[model samples]
Target: MPRSTHRAAPTPPGGLSRRTPDAAVPLRPLGRLHDVASALTALLASDLKEHGLTAPAFHILAVLRRAGPDHRLTTGRLAAIDMVTCSGMTVRADKLEKSGLVVRERDENDRRVVHLRLTERGLRLTDRVLAGLHAREARLTAGFDADELRALAGLADRLERALQHSAGAFRPVPPPH
Candidate 1:
């Protein structure tokens, strides 16, 4: 008779292995990514705080500034671009509006929808914020050669695309007023 080659699983204290061993292992790549993201977020948040804005608010202003000459973005579109909940985005926009950094206008073609535009002050502030951010980014990337910098940018872009693809199936809500 041939002997059985299968090995018995490790027994638990209670005489049963209720969960798989894989579940006990840490996800290293995810952990590392989270740590890096948190650090970057803190740095950006601190920089934006100096301008009396949060990272999300600064991003909103930047997006409006980069929009076409109309300088307007639909609330839904803004929320999508910012990758935030509609309600959360609405709150950010409200704060910006209160600070005289942005204004909400009713879309002419669609009365029910609102468009957001940066105020003159907002544009000026964004310009300053961008200059400062660019300086910081330059300092951080200074260690990298041109090719390495390009590669980093390309990788970042690809990562963003992958994230978007994964989350694209979820429907975005219209931003609240």
Candidate 2:
């Protein structure tokens, strides 16, 4: 038997360099992340729409739940965590309050500062939403075995660290309409 050999086709003159194919050049990893994020966002948004809430409103409820029984978070801190402007947060808080999902109270120690907290109804709603979210997450992970799931989680953590490092210097802008 004779050995076989393979050679890449030669590049066309004045075309893209052989080192980087115009069509096959490596793409930014962030592109894939963005796609995954957009899909997930759409799924969540659809779910929230049925409950008469937007994603941001759902997030506010979730944050309040995580803050424990007190369910209190400063407006400034919540805005920072939610990646929205102070005015935007105020508007969101106002809507949630009117919807009976949250309440605003003056901080005892800082009279000028307002603290946002979830109402009992808000807590119940959060619990229900979280249960649904957990079920969905489990379904997504159902195909993976324990070891594979662990490996996937580890890879995700590493990728998250890389993204966080790079994100400090990159401010995401809204995609063009």
Candidate 3:
């Protein structure tokens, strides 16, 4: 080759691709956390799929079930609690309504506001799914002793708090034109 225009990207100490020069410093631990989270998500997703639910749908159902006897919440409030956009909530509500698991009702006082209420069928399904999920979770964590579990929970809590506190410090990079 007379002259090569291609240059291979440099690999960091652990042979991992570096997004930024400083990324290597935090990559390993964070990578492990991501891996564990992905595995847990897969496990949970499979369980949900068996019950004819996806993760988002399950989350909505769980939130409503937790809201007490009436099993009702304003769409805006549900969207906020679920950390999803109102439009996204609307889409989910549409699917749920079609499934006969939920219903939307205009607010009596304010016609502009809408509420989502779980149906009796939804309530029963949620209860059954939750029971199965809890048992699965217990089995998954059975290997961990109480002290280890506590320590892990404490560390995860700290990480969550730190991430929340520093949320504004990070920004998404724009794609190249």
Model 3, stretches more than 4 Å misplaced?
Answer: 1-27, 169-177
Tens-digit lDDT string for candidate 2 (1-177): 543343334533433223333343232466556666777888888878888889889988888788766988988878887889999999999999999999999988989899898889988888898898889889988999999999988988787667667948644332211
Pairs in steric clash, model 1? none
Best candidate (score: TM-score): 3
* Candidate with the larger TM-score of 1 and 3: 3
Q: What root-mean-square deviation over C-alphas does model 1 reach?
A: 9.1
lDDT per residue for candidate 3 within 16-129, as digits (tens), equals 655544443335777768767987899889988998889999888888888878888888888887678999999999999998989999999999999899999999999999
Better of 2 and 3 by lDDT: 3
Tell me, by lDDT, which candidate is best.
Answer: 3
The lDDT of each candidate is: 0.78, 0.78, 0.81
Residue range 74-156, candidate 1, lDDT tens digits: 88888888777788789888899999999999988989898999889999999999999899889988899999988978987
From the highest TM-score down, the ranking of the candidates is 3, 2, 1
- Model 2: residues with Cα > 4 Å off, grouped in runs: 1-33, 167-177
Candidate 1 — what's its lDDT?
A: 0.78
- Please report, as a residue range, the 10-residue window in candidate 1 with the lowest summed lDDT: 14-23
Task: Give lDDT: candidate 1, residue 162.
Answer: 74
